[model samples]
Target: MAQQALPVLQPHPSCTACDLATWPGLESPGLPTRVWDGGHTEPQPKKALLLVGSHPGVEENVKGSAFVGVTGQFPNRLYIKGGNLADFADVYLTNAVRCSPRTSELVTPKAVAACREWLDQDVRVLAQCYDEVVILATGENAISSVLQRKESLRTFHQGQVADVGGVECSVFATYLAAILLPSNDPSKILAIREHLLLVWRYLKFGYLPTTVKVPPPSELVGSRVLDPSPTTKLISLDVETYGAFERNHRGRLLPRQTVFHPAKSLHWDGVQRCDLVQTCALSWRSPRGGKLRTKVYRLDRRAECDRLVSVLQRLRQCCVLGQNVPFDVLYLRAFNHRFRRVLARPHCVLYELQVLNFLQNDQRAERSLKNLSLVLGVADYRDEAVDLKKGQRYRDSSDPRAWTYNAKDAQATLLDYEFLVEAISLWYGGDTDKWSSYSRQWYNEVLWLTVQMSENGVHYDVEQLGRVHDRHQVALDWLRDRAKRLWDWPMSGKGSGKARERIIADMIQQYQPEDLGLARQYSRRVKKSRLTGKVSAGKENVWLLMGVVPSRTPDRGKLLAYRRFQRLRKVVESYTGPLLHQVSEEKKTPNQQTALVKGVAHPSWHSVPSYASDEERSFGGTSQCRITPRNPGLQTEPPKIEACRRSRFPSGALVLADESQSEIRVATGLFGDEVFIQRETAVLG
Candidate 1:
């Protein structure tokens, strides 16, 4: 590459124009300081890429060069390893701040503003070399200075192209050098790598993807907009729902007067009916030029709602896509029970982009539609462009705002589906049709079954649970009183670990000196901190103390009572209390053969395949995916002794079974351990 030297662009070695130059560390003896004549090419190279960092680090200050230190070399490795750019060395490097601050804290707004003069000159000169320069701003400070934005960087705007110093350049905002360190979170590392790869793709394409602009959704205006294009094969649908209750700052539900009856008692049945579909938006690729077109309709009237269901029923052959398809389907069903038939059709295809995204990436990545769309280079169409406020519910907003929001969501969903389909197809060896078949199989075999399980939850024997709660409460009270009488411990308050340790220490000190053997045993049971010489009251120490205490003494009796109290307390809190709240608020309706027994808890279940841990997978499900119930988390039931209760079927049938060494057996089968399998087979025979 031919280059030109621009020494006039360099700041004076001893320039003290900014307040950062007066910082104490910069004035330290023997540590040379300079107005960092940043990454100007030896002879300012024409037609070269520019890499901008936040500021000079300690090593950069010592070396008097850009990216010469550990932090500087980080981006070098990242660029090469990511395969985005051939060599970082070929890119001109510079900093937003020419002078190194004592610490990052000193690189405040004022310091950045002071350094902008020299920085602007460098960018303007670089603009002369190329029609439009491409700069990678690698931190918040660099991004802010380059974009002339405020202190913070809008994550979604990272890859946006903007004008800097009257020059149009693609400024790629990404992670700081510090995030590239080994000790940083692995997820952050992975995310930056993905961001760099995206930057490469953007440059290779030679076109900037600006925010998507959609015209105001065409209103129904007393007529129907449910008619789909005859040639349309795929449609993205999204619904905006009006929640009957508004959650306060503390998350306590307060019913809206419009939905709630003042004369009737507040109950679950009423609560369930409060939420209704406000509007529905649908977007499909235009048959003419392949542009996505969206239409929104208000479903406030019964006739309008019926029309939506009718339209959905008519689309049995077309595929429906959404961010969380199940959520939209459930809400639609709640709005109109007739939707059940539409969804029940075996030929009906639904693509849930949320689940698809989860399957493709690590759980650490953001799976929400907004974040995923931005990460995948889809237009934002949210935040500033939408003119929405924080903490404001769109469903409660004006019709125009709500409808616009819904329209954008549907459009984004279709765009995201397009991106993910191609990406997944590439992963499947360029077979898009194969990926489509695989996703459909997963939806039919896994997602739908889990949804049904969530809708029709396990039936609990309320009477049996009530009796257990009562018995445990009585036992807990007795234990609390007995413990208070034996030790000076307060029965009403939750005593701290230190308080327990103090009581244990006092008891050990009062042990009869003549009972030296007993004293020795108790002493060995607890360990004292070397610094404070105070005994620990951790659970392990308590268990050890239980083993040493005499069976007949007050200390042993109190210990047993305390242990029993803890077990009962756990049962009361984790099981009884939460389960009591989880019970259906509606009284039991007449049992029908086809229906799940009503008036029982219906906890939601999730199939988190990527998030399943080894322990979670052990008992989670046969497929090794963690299919767990939420709300009360029934899978996390307490130990038998603590529970001292049995859950029977609603019909009162009880059965018990266990597979011994199930994991070992499963592993043997998986790894083709014929010897172990044959042995087990022989034993069974």
Candidate 2:
């Protein structure tokens, strides 16, 4: 089945700018407006469709009509003045809440009340004239003003029909035109116009129009949500510490006496640039990938971290990811807690940046979490470069270095977190596996907001928390001492590295009651009648545990191996590759759904290990291609198994399959283990 394209909801040209009348900060000759084509407006009956919205521009007040600004004027002249819909049912347009809402424009309670009455008047006027009416709330404000469901954007997008003060109504809510279109997309415009045209027709006839309602902008004033299900978010952060700790001959992170690297004040008269005095950069790339676009934010001010507190508060909505995102997050969290600041936003959804491996044994040495970015592979890391530049600028800028660098690093870290999420979407056909799990990680999205790119936190023991190294160290130390004492007969350096092995051999030879080289009565190799064991001579460099020795004696080969249970130095024999968390879902079976905390899977690592013998043989070795018996684990397949084994032997290896190159190839994900097969394989570690 063909997949449908995702709708790219964007601003319409008629509403490219914010309610222009509201933005006092902008210096505009007139509000941006667009006129619609009257030819496009379809004819209707006596039914009047009242379009309700929030922004009423200054031009609209002057012209006494909706959509009359530079942007609105075009649409008005095209659709209204030219007159097509006006021929049938009169089109009455008005704003639900008057005056423009802007970045700094706070709509007072009294102002809203006044606008409410004015909106009701417009609705009442239409109710008196039409036998049937359809009210369309063009934006969130208009829908919310009537529905009192401001946070209903999700549900409102689905369309709704409800009674508003006994006036039969179907409200269709959409984005404000002035806010949506600048980048032209003809198809989208046509679709929206058609939707409106059909909606008007439905109103004119007796047919009930489909409608949806969304939360109004005012209702969202305090509708922040926490606990993103599926998983929490992670926000990664890093800080660049520069200045020396100030103390009275005592080491302490002092506040008062410590001077920020770059002194405050960054006003360059006309141009806001300043000089730098040694600054550090905190860089990070993300989860599965990183941000390709570098964004440098100069932190020249000493109060940079303080300023960042607000930005981060907003960013904590989604999980943030990064290498050691915790370090920055922890630091930021501490700052907020200490300052008693209500971040307004929740704690950063946190995830440690990592590429986890899911295939093979779980004991392989973990790769260094740091310095493992795609940069080595020539991949661009926008977050790293930009943050580095920003740190330099911040150091160069005349601002408090600590504060600026801390927050700037936080931003960089978060960006990387975000980039990883984006990167996963690109590398894979869709966000699947580890990347998908990331969306569920704690504060991961929140962390994503902080950096350009981010990664998952595959548990790394870099600092070796929880005694993994200590246990191995103790075992190795005992063995080292044992080897030293075993060779006490001679301190010569002949077999320096293998002193213990030489000593053991010499001692066994000298103490032989029966000739040590004599062939045993019933065996060729050393045979142990008492235990199921093999002779050490069978394997090269095999360590033999003789009998128990004194615990204090330097003979760990005897004492540690035979008397005590010791954690070996090589316990971690193998490891899988770094991978992102795919999906944490339960695998379903014919019987029942699997348990939670398990649906995760990792990709297969084609980097397989090869043996020297396999490499030398080159042709048709099992290491390169396997040929299993046609019926595995069965008595009937004995001949097939033997044939398969002999074919892979060094003397019988073949270079080509069949008489010539096989043109038609077929591969099913399923592997019929019972059938003999061969395929090329890569040999790596």
Candidate 3:
């Protein structure tokens, strides 16, 4: 099918300062000639919402309405669904640049400046119609126009409230609808839902209900009861670290090059950051129901931390509890030698709230402390007091906000434990022994092993991995040059995805299987879209081209070379490069320096066992590789790319492996399967 003709707009009589006026196409027949106004149809909207998009699209220009195109309809659908809108008719919609640009890129700063007069007119009309307006700006241009600034989108955060034209509005600025429309990622969808919910919440209430004041850390610690009752069986603890929160998708901290970690420590921003324990909050509460006696320890102050050490020594006698308690334990051990020594003592019982929650609820249920607290009716101040989106952390010892946040976390953990214990007890038919046995054998045991693995992290051969990474880079560069020379197309940049698709389609149309020197059976296997008439460049097609050989036509050569290039790129990007980064560059600890090593990486591991009959136990790598044991994880490294596994374990390390049917044999023997056991023994023999 041929591409549709581009839409064109006639030059406005008022202005002709830019080339957008000269951009050509067919004259729009049914579209509005004049700038469009918002809320023209609605006389009295109960809850007025003014949505501002960057510019009108081809479809919107053709339809004579703002936000009616595919991109616009996506957000409109979300707003109607999530925000409880009666319909699109209930809300006012307009664009910053009223005239549809030939392309979004053509709607320049100068064009936006010229069109600001029209946008201002729309805002004024909408503001007057409603006593209070909720403005949702969906792009940089719209945000800048509404706020009357020349700054970029980074200057604003999502769900921010601002005064527009002397009218207070619960305003929100986010990625354009066009950008978000193509993404099917659940996180992105959830984020938009959260953003819309915040907008509606702020519209109803004057402010977000997150603000809470607490007694200062000094005062809290001063009044802290160090000695708990002899009968106390559980103590819940929580910690606020300096650089553990606010990570991007790749797990890199947002606040890089800060004093939180030494500049030398972040050569590649090690897999696990050198996060410091800012404050440790420990609580001893009545499991029945009452307020918790929580102590917020300022770890930066040596005097205050000593008091915390005394309490930690007593933890062995009582069961220590917290949400993700292993994380707190890891940071605490790193902070003080005495704390580590106290924790190393045998018979230490640790109760992790996350693990317990996982067993009690569905495996997919969110187990964050805030979420758990909210559902348990404990507290909902996760967003209050701190701006996590802005990468807020415990920057200094003097900040009371971090201390209060820490205190709240400890208190909430205690409350969550109380709730979960009862919930689990009731779930187990009030059989305390059954639940206790399960917790002891599964949750606590896994937590102990995970903490131990993290403390003694595996070592890697960085120099060897670096050599492999460099070789992959050289090969990739050669392939890119070859591609550019043959097709005059850049193969490794922003437009590469689209370029790959076009290249694949061309290869399929122009060349036969014999022409590319591939088997005829492999040809015509690529799936083409029925609607778009475009060939898929998905992983399946790429794999089919793996055996392709160089041929006469540049199309075949390009396709074969590109496929090889992608294979090498994946190894470097996913395996070798990240493995090299996983090795820490921080200054070694005293013991590490004595042994002449750089640093250690504490990659995360997770295990969750569902008691249900159908679901199997889930376990393996969580962060560093984020792959599972089934055809994945660090343990399942391919033979060619064995640098990580080969270099990881030290000399004299004892590696364990489970023989096939090990668990099956034990179960069958326990159930008195004498014939099966004899057959198993004969097979093994």
Question: Which lDDT value does model 3 have at 54?
Answer: 79
Instruction: State in Å the error of residue 183, model 1.
Output: 10
Q: Worst lDDT window (10 residues) for model 2?
A: 572-581
lDDT of 2 by residue, 1-685 (tens): 2222211212122332223434454232222222123422343345665656555455655554456666455335433343244454545555554554432123333334445544555455456655554665654556666665552222342124546556756655443444334653222233234335535455445443321111222221121411112222344444432221222112222232121111111111111122121122223333235422111222334344343444454444544444454333433333335212422224544555432211111111111221212211112122322233222322222234333334344444444345555655664657366445544553344443432211110122222321443454466556556545664432223553244345444433443346444524212322221111212221121222242122355544343442232224222111111111112112112111111011111111111122111100111112322211110111122221213222223355534233112221223114543232333222111
TM-score of each: 0.60, 0.27, 0.58
Worst 10 residues of 3 by lDDT: 612-621
CA deviation > 4 Å runs, candidate 2: 1-236, 242-302, 314-318, 333-346, 355-423, 426-428, 431-433, 437-439, 442-498, 504-543, 547-685
Q: Pairing residues by index, what is the TM-score of model 1?
A: 0.60
Candidate 3 wrong stretches, greater than 4 Å: 1-218, 223-230, 244-275, 286-289, 344-346, 356-395, 416-441, 470-474, 477-502, 508-541, 544-554, 581-601, 606-636, 643-650, 653-685
lDDT (CA) per prediction: 0.59, 0.34, 0.57
Alpha-carbon shift of residue 501 in model 3 (angstroms):
5.0
Better of 1 and 2 by TM-score: 1
- The candidate that wins on lDDT is 1
Write model 3 residue lDDT over 1-685, tens digit each, in one string. Answer: 2222211223233455544555564133222222223323233433456677777778876665666787767665666445654332236666666667765655666666666665545445555545556777776677777776743333344445566655666666544566554442233443345456656655556444432234466656653535455456788788776553444323444443232212122333342333456677777755456445666777767777787777666555687888877777876776666777876636567888866675455322235676546445565653566665456554454566666777788777877777767877876667665357665656677777877765665554566656777888899889888888878767776687678788776666544465454545555576654223356776677665544535575555666677787788777655565555432112122211111125334455455432211011112224221112221134544445553433344555435454446567778879988889888879879
Candidate 2 lands at a TM-score of 0.27
